[model samples]
Target chain A: MHDSAQDDVTTMTFEAFADTILPGEKRFPGDVTVAGVAVGGGAVASGAVAVLRTDEGGMAPALDNLAEALNGHAGGYAAERGLSLDPAVPPFVALSFADRTELVARLTAPTHPERDIWVSVAMFSTIAFDAAAHLHTVDALADGHPGMTTMGFKPPEADGLWRFPEFSYGRQLARPHPDTTPSGSPA
Target chain B: MTAIESTDVVVVGSGFGGAITAYHLAAGGARVVVLERGPWLTGQDFDQDFKFGSSSTRAFDFTIGDGMSVLAGNCVGGGSVVYFAAMPRAPRFVFERHGSIGRRMWPAAISRDTLEPWYDRVAEALPVTRQDWSDVPYAGGLWAAACHHAGRTANPVPVAIDNERCVNCNWMMSGCRFDAKRSLLLNYLPAAIAHGARIRPLHEAQRLERSDDGGYRLHYTVVDDVDYRVEVGGGAIDAKVVVLAAGAGATPVILQRSADTLGPMPAAVGRYFSGNGERLNTAVIDEDRVREVLGLSRSDGVPYEAYQIGKGPCVATWDRLDGSLPEYLRYSLEQLYFPPGFGTILAQVPDATGPTWFGAEKKELLRHWKSWLTIFTMSEDDNEGVFGPPPPTGNAVRVSQQMLGRGALRYRPTENTLRGWAASDAEVRDILERDGLARVMPWTNDVVGAYTVHPLASCRIGDDPATSALDDRHELRGHPGIFVTDGSAVPGALTVNPAMTIAALAERAVPAIVEAARQRGVAVRYGAPAPDGATAARDAVLPLVAGRAGR
Candidate 1:
């Protein structure tokens, strides 16, 4: 009955931990230009807000999805980028605006407090959210909070993989390349 | 207005030690009152994934060891409610060694037999069991693999967890989502309440004073929705006894504050604090090897690996605090990592002062990670103070922690220690690289002082009242009736977790306390009639998972 065998991330139905710990929040006006589409590797840019939804509350395991989306199902993304990240960790992606070109950074050394621990910044991105739902309530400070009163928890580094055409990308958050990939399924 | 009430025994601090103590006394017929600073967290209240506390308030903003930002649960359950829930006992020989260090009775005089039963009592209550390996045999592979590689498996630890309730919260540090970890929330505190112990959470104790005839006048505050503190003026509770189970850090502060009535300044108290000679060292297991030892479903999010070194199953030792790991064991791990799993092995050095402290400077800490097969080792230090670290330079002395890696005790090293860690840096580097983990500085293998899990000997017990804080039975000599049943009474270091010992001592002192009160002519009848044997209707207990699980 114990999922102790699974990674720390898999033990939950919807990932509420990373959501809370690293913490991410975003709010948009309901009237903002909204478009929803699937997300792929690369970056996800949307004026309206959007969210990722996996088929199940459990979602496809983080690594599997990361591998599919970040490197493309058959390792296409890595092949294209010619990057050398270990496959040991599933390909995970990060949620970012088009111009924030910096690839998120992560701590990989063991001496660090969380050396072997795995976290998929990219994968957590494509989950379900209600941009429309957010508009229903206001954080009063959205207009007055000093700094990032909200954030879509960009990955500190690429820890997992993504599922192509599997992402929900739109201004209301948009569906990115995944939906637009040549084949109906992200190719 | 002050709400005053009295009881046969008053327990302060809702940690495992105090909770257990209260539970025993209440069940034994004494009416008990328990005070905690945190709220009750039940399964339903567990829904907060990131904000740990149902309310986003942090555990404790108070400063503890060396300006470190401390966090102890303010919830009804206390420390156990927030700990990783490991219940190892002090080694049998730990208390038998006061003479070796030029001190008498380091293992304060107490019967092991009296505490033996409680150990089992506690284990059963938690329904604590070993982690099940069938489904994810390799998940918690790290510890097991390391043990085998180290040849330390014969004494693997027995965790106080209900495996059935465990889930992949992957955030044990934040707190367990599954109730499997028998933290105070699920065990002691509940049983105490069942035995008629009343716990008032969010009642932050700010000051304490002994009333003339005895008992206590506690000044506490109440926190409401608006985060406003409502002062409940000091009120006197004419109880016959009070047990201070507040943690090592806070316990000393209490004694230090009431130095006059509490008794003479003991050369102990907060002295010789060790984070269990606790260390964070890594054993190299490649990516694939990591999988072999610790089974991880890449998709699952984290390795379900359960790994640990040092004491367990029965006793804890200053076993860690240093990496004098035998050579053969090291070879065994290297041998185990036959096939490559992860590229390099990882060893995370957790600190009692991580982030949030030291300006929470992540930038500086990140730089220390370069080329190191990292791990932190906390060792037991014998030289402690009666009063605490000297002031003026207390700040500067705190920063000297960097010197711990090579700081040696004045005398001989413990039976299984490096005589001089300062000379082993090259050896460690060679040993690790030869074994395929990482290359690091020369003193990596030296004798670093242990950070300790807060073991203490303040108000330590002794025969002579003039020299120590408390006498043979944990009673402050001056007050005669006042007692310290928590870690505040230990006379020496414990090579294992002190909870079991603390509980045992506290339980042992009760009989004596009652006897004294009787001798003093106080009517000590066991409290109100017990309802049918079933535990009293539960207190506002909280579960690990919000609503998903039942208490």
Candidate 2:
């Protein structure tokens, strides 16, 4: 079945969550730990995670448990976060972007039982961020986003011709026949 | 009271095999109707983005024994629409690999001589050529240098792409956006449609029954929608001749599903499955060299072109120099270029390493996107595997098993043959190290996700029904009007891209099929003789596509 994780993340909270995890312009230059501008806007990041989970499986249910844990009703995930006894706040779906990010960070903290949730969602989000923020254009990369361009990458011109300098080696390999046979050929 | 649509011939699965068969048969003047499970995707529908082509429904991704997923395209043009477009002819050693068995099956069932002309016809219809050094992106240069340093030949690999029209956007994996890649959608399917062939895109074949009128009755479903799960409704058709070209993975399941009504198949029905011994090895070159060598240095405000463009053709291939091993057993290296954006997330890595290397390390890899080059080694498999009784993984299994037999569809790769793929990886690393062009990545023995793009064998052809599924003519032995003509009919791996050979074999098989329909009193109009099939060449088959006519 198609994982509906993407459908769940299309709201403002997921976008805020994405931005918190990978803020494009929020972080200062050379400070990896510094905060950056928010990343998620469209359904791309969540959708990518959903797609990955569809093939890889397991991520969907973990996401479900994390969501439930945040609502403070089911799973010890919230209890471990010391929120199990707290009056059930708004459903994870209703939480604000900052609230959602805080909830996700706590759930995915190294000490948290559901840290793997961060791994799947974060990896997919990071990849999605590259495609959406950096790959399409340099404007996307330099808008406080660290990508290939930030590293001063000089990407190749895919349209024009450039000499390979090893053409002769290739031609030698493409030469014609020897009427060869298999190892077990009956001579 | 026949509650089904009828046609002169019903070709299942519009892939390289089915599409080519439809073209030849329709050209031959037979009333042809094709049933494809995927949508009729045009070039415009293809997107350059990473997630654009990752349709769960359109691209059939299923796992078999050991929980490793094997992928195959499910669109109208089948695998040809989603492959690397690398079209190398089966070498003599490939056909002569299994001793007498290979000899009989190779030349007798579908001779290279019979196929060379069809290959030419296909080439003429599509754009097949090799790119010199000037033809590819900077990544191509790395491959050429590595081959040269290793003292191996790096021949140009022929791809069905028109260089003139190609922008080298390198999004061939998601389907070509510029329409430069000559998939069957452009060539064979269009020709078939022009010649009066009916293509039903979302109509998937479900079951087969022998009609009372001595024809074949096919039960199918019209797919309403295919997202994460396949949503389908029932349908049916009747035809005098039924050609099964679903795929090596699906065709056996289709036949096995209908086995009760069709009676027993040979013991080798799902046996002899090969993964073509495919393996992937990647390395990172000096990031500065990408800009310095390719002249793609940073300008003031130019957008960083993170996508792979102009790297369309596989660029180069390195063959095994030592003639000691069988040609089929020999390994060849090809290069792969992924858009940096997509590579950051989806590129191959050591097994279970992706999740752990998040945040910084992942960013570091993305930072040097232009420096990474993935080399693929496609070695011919020894043909020892099966496809059936897999744990229910996806809808293809659930639905097909509901119609056919339970536990009838699974793909089992040969452990030993797969182990043999390790050397090819090592060889690629050695070449890279020798060239000093790049630093080799850690080798991952993740054969579970072992890619089988060129899946062949399973329902193979031979002279005996006891040992083989089909006869020398590609007829399903006991079943007169039934034929299996896709990659499943190949007895062994071609040691190269099998699309051209598969299409060529379909071209050769159709004339005989037309003759059979004629004997059955089906009115089939024989079109002009195929460009190559008409004039059978007596010369020894050349090495690859470039040797066939010329670049």
Candidate 3:
């Protein structure tokens, strides 16, 4: 396990990175990780850090390294623009949202040798905000995952399975197969 | 190693190719054992999560190469377990067309007419169903309507699915939890099991060698499905006949590994690869136009409307195989829907109006996420791809034990393929923008180096050993009992999804395999006889071609 202080810096850096990709409102008072540049819930609120920490995300071990690299880029970006980063937060978190976005563009540029790594980081952020990918569909729906809820995803029935007897076209254009049963299985 | 086990036949992989072959051979009364490197995941185990890479339990393996990345399912039912279930047959021209060398890519013995009976057999088992107009999901309907407005037809494809049971969850690629999708697990595999074939999940085949008694010895290891960690237990299985159905991305590696002990493999072990010219594009439908098409009035107080792309089957393809395009340039357009989480990944729309891939504009686009349509295009690409030793520079995943130290795929689109892609892109953009119904966006600016799930023809079948890994009989040249029956054996791009064609080829090869086993003094009983009228239909279509001289 990483030291708590180091972990905090890494978490803040990722939170800021995810925020640049998909911004959201601040979680609560005194929350310094999220930039809160945009309106509705975003990658931070959608559990981007939690998703990244999961074993399935395969990003946990690389978090520290990624944060260091991001901060290095942020420092370079700040130096190139003749702007000083805030001393209170991690280097990446200290930059303005616009600066962060521009730095990310450079990191994800097609010609960059490490483009795939940065792209993967951005993708994980989007996955958290879009699908709550780490959570089970039922559990995510029940918990009202910000992304799923915002997308208006329908919840499953009590049996934990979705069954839509009604057609999306308002009316059925073809009859069900002769072997189809009431439960929808082929008899 | 544990004591060596003996079986009449040992099959690698449990996908469409392996499952079909196992079922036929096991039914024929041959003692069969199937070794699958991935776990046996059922409907209960499936979820909408986009589990990818080697770490995921679903084992969606990714082999990132220099110019192309290949995705293949590493599970019991193989590609069929995770496929979209589209079962369209290859057009006749795929077999008839000649390559740039002026030589026909496919063997003369293998053609649509010859494979019709085998295709029919697979269709009956899976019970392929063509979706009715009512059965078409919203995304498919939108595509059809767009095509109609553009004076083209978007037809519902025949799919290997029980449509009645489908809840339109749009999770077909992730494996259907509803058991609605007719994957090989639902049919061929169960049948194979019932016929007494032993399916050993998490058993990875490492190497192959000839046994002292003229049979083949398959060396394998027990692996943990989650991390693919090789466990302590391992043994060799000796069998009279060995079938390599480990998919296009894998079969070549296995053969390459066996070359030293089994004798030097043919030069064409990993040549003529194809990604099936697969490309993904997106179109954002205009909300007002969407409402107009759905007949919704302005008075309706719905602030944000959903297109319900996630509530239907994965794809409803638009057939563009008309003769307006040259034979090599024929392609099909499929309106695909990824589930919520996975769908947003496609949000990287290359040419969005403002602030592409981030910020307020991207968030706004996410707000209307339901209105986005992902269009997947598949064309008949020139098989210019090759699978060889990993290049020194690129990041390559270790896919097999001894592929001369990790196999890597290198591919670049030929001139014809690029033209086909451009034409298809223009057509899709035109259809989407008909009367300004939607804003079109290319998925990626890098069209030549795109990823594909449909990696094919790595160990293609042909008449010449110099250019083909397997002969027309699906057997490796100079190695009679070793056969490759999978997407690896397909000669060229099928111009449609290759699952059905792969299954059909496996079906066609089974009888020959059984006969050969018998001739080799191995007592093999034939089972799962051809469907009634299949033989007569095949006979009427064309006489069975005699074995060519190359063998």
Say which candidate scores most in DockQ. 3
Name the best candidate (by TM-score): 3
**Which candidate do you rate higher for DockQ, 1 or 3?**
3
Candidate 2 C-alpha error for residue B535, in Å: 8.8
lDDT of 3 at B485: 94
DockQ of each: 0.02, 0.11, 0.26
- Model 2, A1-187: lDDT tens per residue? 6556534533223333344444443223542212332332322332334433343332444554544444542234444454433233224434433444556656655455655445346544554555532133333343433443433333333532221222211222222123322211111
How much does each candidate deviate from the true structure in C-alpha RMSD?
A: 18.3, 8.5, 5.5
Off by over 4 Å in 2: A1-187, B52-67, B99-114, B225-232, B288-307, B321-323, B326-329, B339-363, B390-416, B442-448, B464-467, B525-551
RMSD of 1: 18.3
- Candidate that would win on lDDT: 3
The worst-scoring run of ten residues by lDDT in candidate 2 chain B lies at: B398-407
Q: Report the lDDT tens digits of candidate 1 across residue range A1-187.
A: 5454343323221122222212223223431111111121111121011212221112233433332333332144345556554444333222221101112222212133321122122222211121111111123123321111221211111322111111111111111221111111111
Query: Could you give candidate 2's per-residue lDDT for residues B421-524 as a string of tens digits?
Result: 66676777787755244566532333223456677788887765655788877888778899888998887766566777777677556656776777767776
The better-scoring model by lDDT among 1 and 2 is 2
